[model samples]
Target: MLKIVYPICCGIDVHKNFVVATIATTDRENITTYRTKRFSTFTKDLRALALWLSNNQCVHICIESTGKYWIPIHNILEPSCQITLAHPKYVKAIRGKKTDKKDSIWIADLHKHGLVPGSFIPPADIREIRDLLRYRSKLVSFASSEKNRVQNSLTVSNIMLSSVVSDTFGKSALAILSHLLKHPDDQDFDFRPLLHGSMLKKQNDIALAIDGTINDIQAVKITLCLSHMDDIKRSYVARGTAF
Candidate 1:
């Protein structure tokens, strides 16, 4: 059971472009070092890395998670080998001069002594849900950005729609604002939606806010972005399908 419980271990210092690895033998006397190779986080790269680590007889591995950058590598290696995802904030090194190679070596040394503590790595299905949430967050951000751009365009053209209306994207605001963008004439500022609660007893201010002419090119760009945001939302709803 001694051989089964304790086996060869590796420590990896992962970065955006390359990975630094160190291999250590667990026998009481003989310690080995191999840190000259570099591996990528791509699928092919990870498969090669797993093969190499297997060849070297590394039973377990440790890595510091740097945001979303570490997940792909962890996912690739976790199925076939034992991997501990170390938290960067939890496992900080001494604040002095340090290089990538030296950091990798230090991590390996710590693992040999059973000193490093790892954070949680959820099951595969939970991980997939997390990824979907992450993508949905980006889509929400894109939608907000496009709305801000449209509001800024109106502001630039002397339209104070945001000042008079609670939401410049509301029914009354969109009715007038869309008309103005389609036709730059001030008369195109029709407040027909003000017949409903959108007016909110502020018909005059709502009409005043809709009188401006934006650059045609800027309007075109904002429209395309709005269209793209719609596409993103639809794609997210159909998440489980293969791309």
Candidate 2:
């Protein structure tokens, strides 16, 4: 027989709208009693559940980490209970039936036998920092995608901007492209005026690179990509500042 690590423990099957909880208790005679309850995933209901658990003298609680749904519940019960954030795969129903109640009971039984392995849950402040970092990472990825789109647009127009400049999205390249986009039909366009710093040395090459057939459609797409990149950059800076 498996030893009971926790003689009295509760298991919670978390969902988006509700949670199913099962409380199990084992006596000196090795007799076990199980009681189940359902609670809505609301603040009031969660508080009631906490009260019920407290009344039963149950402090050990095992909860399945189901997406973002478990965070709020964990927040509500963290102070009162010894919470174990278990992975759902580790608490799967290996026998009889598969229902919310059954899942909760199974988890409680597993916790009783010390079979539930808890997942790592960082402190609240660390979790907030992690969320901000993840958001910033996504923004950075989107900005890179937009940069690639801009480069691809330039390539499609037979523009050798990227081949000439180390970064096609650099300030010098953008200034040249802006001039070319504005005066698409100016065959005798003087690009020396847009060349700045070391770019002045490559005046002839920059002129040759800008000489491309960028039609109205390609120009519009390129403008949109640049605009989106600007917006992403602004957001990235703002998020970094927020951190």
Candidate 3:
């Protein structure tokens, strides 16, 4: 015989705009009663749902993971309810007969017998850190892609800066590139002033590498790529500070 783990519990079917909730109350005689309600996904409606659950003395709640739709509901109910966040497969309803109310009821039935397993959710602080780190990672990836675009622009324009310097964006290379962009028509400008440290020894090679022509369009593309890379770097630093 199945054991009645929670004498009274609620199950929720989360959606983007709304949710359906059903409360299951089981009696000692093995009888179960259900009361289902629909609520909007807005904060006010979710608060009312929490209040309704509190009033019915139902603290154990089960809900299926449905994209980001379940996040707001979980946030609103986290303070007052013992929420069981189950994978959708664990609480799936019968095919061809699935309705919001029916799904909620099915979840409630599974939860009532302690048949539902909750997914592992880190604490609030850890979740916040995780989100920030993930966003920073994306920023780093964007910056790398922008750097690649800049390198491609240089390569197509016959700018062999990458071949002469270990880092094309290094101080000396950028100084030479900046001068080239500012004085696009003056190819004979001396490279000695831009050459620094060990780069001074490779002055001849560096000058030869940058001797190629860079059209107006290629120059503009390189400029835009550098600008975007700078923006991504700033965002990455800001996100790290937020962490």
Each model's lDDT: 0.73, 0.88, 0.91
Whole-model lDDT, candidate 2?
A: 0.88
How well is each residue in 1-243 modelled by candidate 1, as lDDT tens digits? Answer: 213233477778899877877776655554455544578777898788888888987768888788778877887888788887887765567789998777776677666666778788889988778877877788778889988888777788778878987887776667776676667655654456444584768877766766666778777875776677668768867864622
Write candidate 2's Cα lDDT for 1-243 as tens digits: 989899999999999999999999999877889999999999999999999999999999999999989988998999999999998899988876589998999999999999988998888889888998888788889888988888888888889888778878778888878876888887567777666678778877777777778899989988998899889878757766774
Q: Residue 201 of candidate 2: its Cα lDDT? A: 85
Best by TM-score: 3
Error of 1 at 90 (Å): 6.7
Every model: Cα RMSD to truth = 4.7, 1.7, 1.6
As for TM-score, the candidate ahead, 1 or 3, is 3
Model 1 scores a TM of: 0.71
Cα shift from native, residue 84, model 2 (Å):
0.9
Question: How does each model score on TM-score?
Answer: 0.71, 0.93, 0.94
